[model samples]
Target chain A: MSSWEPDSDFVFHMPTKVLYGPGSHREIRAEMADLACDRAVIVTDRGLRENTDLPARIQKALGATCVGVFDDVEPDSRFEIVDAGAAFAAKLGADCLVSVGGGSSMDTTKAISIVMTNGGSIREHLAVHALTGPQTPHIAVPTTAGTGSEVTNVALIKDEAARTKFFVLDNQIFPRTAILDPTLTTGLPAGLTASTAMDAMTHAIEAITSICRNSMSESFAVQAIGMINGAIRRAVEAPEDILARGTLLSAATMAGAAFCNAMVGVVHAVAHALGGVCSVPHGIANSIMLPHAIHFNAVTDAEAYAPVVATLGIKASSPLAAAQMAAARLTELAASCGLQTKLSQVGVNRRQFQEIADKAMADGAVLNNCRPVAGPEEIVALLDAAF
Target chain B: MAVVFPTAEWVAEFKKQIDEKPDYKEGGKGWREGVIVLIINAKPQVGIDADFNIYLDLHEGQCREARVCSDEEVGDHPFVIRGEYDRWKLVVLDQLEPVKAMMQGKLKLTGDLPTIVRNIDGAKTLVKCATYVETVFIDE
Candidate 1:
């Protein structure tokens, strides 16, 4: 076992009320009433708005409280989109937001709420702990079973000007309620299902090994790891299986809660960089980098990965061996799910490695990494290996 | 003789120690953000009647200046961290982590939090430098 000591002091706070079931999303009107919000706007993407009937169903469920829908959110959430969303909601006199779809939609809604309440550009509120009070009431209805953005206090918004993604971490952005309805996630394609499930897996692993992790966060992370390990393959294979979908959704939320409090580590840092630099989808980038990050972190925090090995049902002779086996098991799992295993497969070449490394070195998530990163050279090395 | 906390001598010693530590130099490389002011709120019962503001002009892995200054003199810095005298004592004694203390509301920080968070190793190194100063707490 690792000789790491428990933190001297830590705080655990998860206030978002979660409602889960087959059609729990229909309760959004009641949630709006509870928050004392009258005019609600549905924040989503154009694809879902045009193609799926989910938005129409939500609008019907919300009844007269749904004033309008803002469906301009792009695949990678951007500052301009958040500003436009805020303008749309403000113009509609929306007192509450109901975000529908994946992480981008939820994160855009969070940024819109910030801009509406704080009365400033989204760029002004990009820093951590920037909010002084609670934002506009928000109810997050996650259509995907990954990202856990509904329950997290973080919002990853891209800056088109800088060609980089900035993290917004504030306690007030936690959605007033999170509606996890398996019916919403059952339509996800097999590829997205596998990638997002691996995203949750990465969050769980990074949370457990993060330097700031405490007993409570560790509990959540460990549970999430076990749940994702058991449900990922089944969910990917049987996309219409409600039970598997529900388990994965709940596990994603649990992982979200864990990483939000304890914070994520190197995998997230590197993945965020890749998402910004190369436009790799966040979940896919995380899927490609998770095993590499585990191996890199194991050099300094082998004992921390022992719990992960046990949770993955792998028997090992020692902590370091357990960590290595855990990394190998993750690679096998991703391959079994048909996730891309290399940066090269995702169009990231050696020429872009240095820039990604520099961004990763500056990312806030790097501070919580188990090993102290010396410089960009170390990150470049990891990129080369993963490439 | 041990240097008293919140004194000019202590700040000087901290600067000297930070400059000497190879770990801080290596960890703090490329930290060109700006000045950071640490304000220790006073407790009259502990013989501290006024808030103590320690100005640290940190740039590119070096402490260009370290001194005790008034609040009015600390103009336009990118970061300011304020906490109770007792809380800072615990931090200096290595009983509490600085980032955790900030998250828990024991310390109130004003500035770009991401910059501070991104360079946490440098912050920890600064705290380590403080510990090297043989401290005589005012209350004690």
Candidate 2:
């Protein structure tokens, strides 16, 4: 039986145009033109600027229209970096943005676009539905298979002073186009591939079990889960396999589309808190917490998770058993991928559990958890168990 | 006779229903937040010639007050939800979910989103209260 009732009402919307192929990144000019944007700025990081030729290739593809490159984005994109990037883009007379890296870079571009058009500090527009209409045109070329920031309407910006991250969600911030070029992700290291694929997997699972999930989001989540399950191992072990890489990239976008509408659950809430409190990498935190979160919500969401079990290729006696097995299988899969399976392995301490729990309680994602958490103590217990 | 929506009587009745519901009292226990002002945009075609502001003084699972307020009286409330008259009608009629409507840009919400999101059950209870009111559509 489906989680949604026959008479349940839902609203589904996906506005961004996605171009997926081996070398779709080269279509930057056409994508920009589709939005009637002329001057484009490439928003990325210094690592991609120094190590890879992807930025240059996109610049060349955009030719005269590509005004400049802003590579000031950090690993966890900060508010200051977005402000600086926005100023740089505005100075260059850039009318559009082409983000050319992972989640941080793409999210930076989204924030920069908001600041450029709205003409204020990124902090001013922190509320949901903050923007009245669209912001600057943005084309996201994701070099990592995680985050799926290209399709999501949210940008996670860290506040250095507060030592926590905050979400800026608005439909207008969704990238105008997502260029999923698998070749851009083929050179990722084994650990990154594993961690990022796990991130996508977590997104699919959480979307499936989120209280707000509808048929359309569930369909995408299921498809993404199946694809990631089939391709993640090959994509990680044989990093150069284009087919596996492409599958993971496509699945990540599908997962993004799913969770963007349905929203995620406690896994993301805890992961965001971990990223904020401990400086643990987002994907790594999600990879470590995915199975544990599943276990926590499984009792209440067994029916919703049963499909995830099948998608993960697990066989079980019943829905509840299937949910439990699904959690166990995720642990095994994370271990096989060489991902850190516990918070302790990632340098998180018992003392920090309280702070992490406090932050997680305040997270927007927690609202949609299949199981309602009474207080921070429950999260502390979950963290203790994961530890 | 059905109380005409946007009138002072409708707001009083809505508050009465909210106070009577045990679900609202229980579900809203966590909601110690400040007032929520609903701005119903004018639809002149439907005879609502000017914007209507309904101020809800809600705290700790109780409706302290529900009354009509002027623009100046809205005054620094923690949450403000603005939408077309028709959209608000759909929400009051339980045909549309408020959170989903906000997510879809059909309604504009200005507040700490996480707080509102966390108290979604409370919000739903408030909406249920609206449905209990015997309302007559102004357009009809």
Candidate 3:
């Protein structure tokens, strides 16, 4: 019964079969056998290779078909890598595209799943891109809670030509089910914890302010905001706090689900561009840029910001104070997590920003931002403000 | 304005306070090293010199070496929280608050992300087992 209509034409969809809570991967593997999957392509990263035993666990648990490993992934996954993974899936005759990491693996799997069924280079299907044809079943096993790729049809692939991040979003790519397991994230480092937590926060706030905002999205975003506001610091400070980690996992999953349906805006649009151009890490880029983006958008919805401030639990003597408080709090949270809240600190400069901005304006994400980005100029201005 | 605590005696006082807290000891059970906090004036909003760092170390269960940041001694902070001295102290002394400052940008931190979380978990407390002149944020 998960159905919602947008305007007069589009309808929103969420994954029907969801496996949530700790150690849910086992249950997900059980479903693979039920689906009669013989072999599956495991799309993952080099980091996961060392940190977890996902591939082996899958092989042991499901007794299903196992495609050869495709671990040629970077933190900011590239288009070429996804293209290679797709070919690998085809070579293995893999029926299902199984992802075993965060956005990097899940997004890569989505792109590859489409390319496996469609006969063309990824470049062919660029904007408003649809599979336009039948595709193999895709299953998402999210190791982290951010980017809600498991629940949405959005697949972000890095475009080398435009040097931008593009979402090949369509209903066909949504995974049949998503595995939300908190144990999967216990080993996450503090930097990743803080960075990804902020990434989820960005997703929630951006969705809350999106042009397409609605009741369902607001409900999810509000819950996400509260969970993060209460538990993120504890998760960042204590890796072993399963309760805190679980809360963050839920928060991230909720944020991901919210944005996947509602879409994201400038912060993500700009973050995606930075990832493609400079190869900056997605979570860190979001952590550093979210404040500036939020500040920039604040002027667009001053009254709306009041609810956000209340959600953040801020009380100021004045509006100016409130604004300044929001900015400072962003910096402090990032700093406490061993992150700096500035693009300047992360090696992004004015010259590079101009190029990134041009690409970001064209990115699909900006359309969802509360204040529409008019052109590269406004993008650069935001970058300047962040710096 | 000098550090709100001023007396420099507060440095030793923090060492004493840190040693006295069983929760701090339990929270930091696995944390074996120390960290230095760099409090730059940023702007001489309150008074005092423009820059200085506080060198605080957590060794096993004891708090050691609370000193002023000497000239030519920049920071190699394992974990760092940066801001105006007043705001920094407000957090350190458990006065400023957590969600309040994070939302306001009064407190900032940097260093290894993994270790940061580990330290907090080991310490089992927030504001990362102090290492500040005063306790900041309520105990979580």
TM-score-best of 1 and 2:
2
Model 3 per-residue lDDT at A123: 57
Taking all chains together, each candidate's TM-score versus the true structure is 0.89, 0.93, 0.68
lDDT of 1 by residue, A44-152 (tens): 9999989888888899999999999999999778898999999999999999999999999999999999999987789877655546798999999998988999999
Error of 3 at A308 (Å): 2.2
lDDT by residue (B13-69, candidate 1, tens digit) is 888888887767876775888688888988888877888889998877788889998
Q: How far is candidate 1 from the true structure (C-alpha RMSD, Å)?
A: 3.1
Model 3 lDDT tens row, A54-128: 655655555546656788776656678877887888888888877888887888887888888885766555423
**Top DockQ model:** 2
Residue-by-residue lDDT tens digits, candidate 2, A45-127: 99998998889888999999999999989988889999999999999999999999999998889899999999888887676
Superposed model 3: Cα runs more than 4 Å off: A1-11, A34-36, A317-324, B1-140
CA shift of A5, model 1, Å = 3.8
Q: Which parts of model 2 are misplaced by more than 4 Å?
A: A1-4, B15-33, B59-65, B71-78
Q: In candidate 1, how many Å is residue A150 off? A: 1.5
**In terms of DockQ, which candidate is stronger, 1 or 3?**
1
Q: Write the per-residue lDDT of candidate 2 for residues B79-101, one digit (tens) a residue.
A: 88889999999999999888768
Model 3 C-alpha lDDT per residue in residues B13-82, reported as the tens digit of each score: 5656577666567666667657645454444444454565666676655566666665455445555545
User: What is the overall TM-score of model 2 with all chains considered together?
Assistant: 0.93
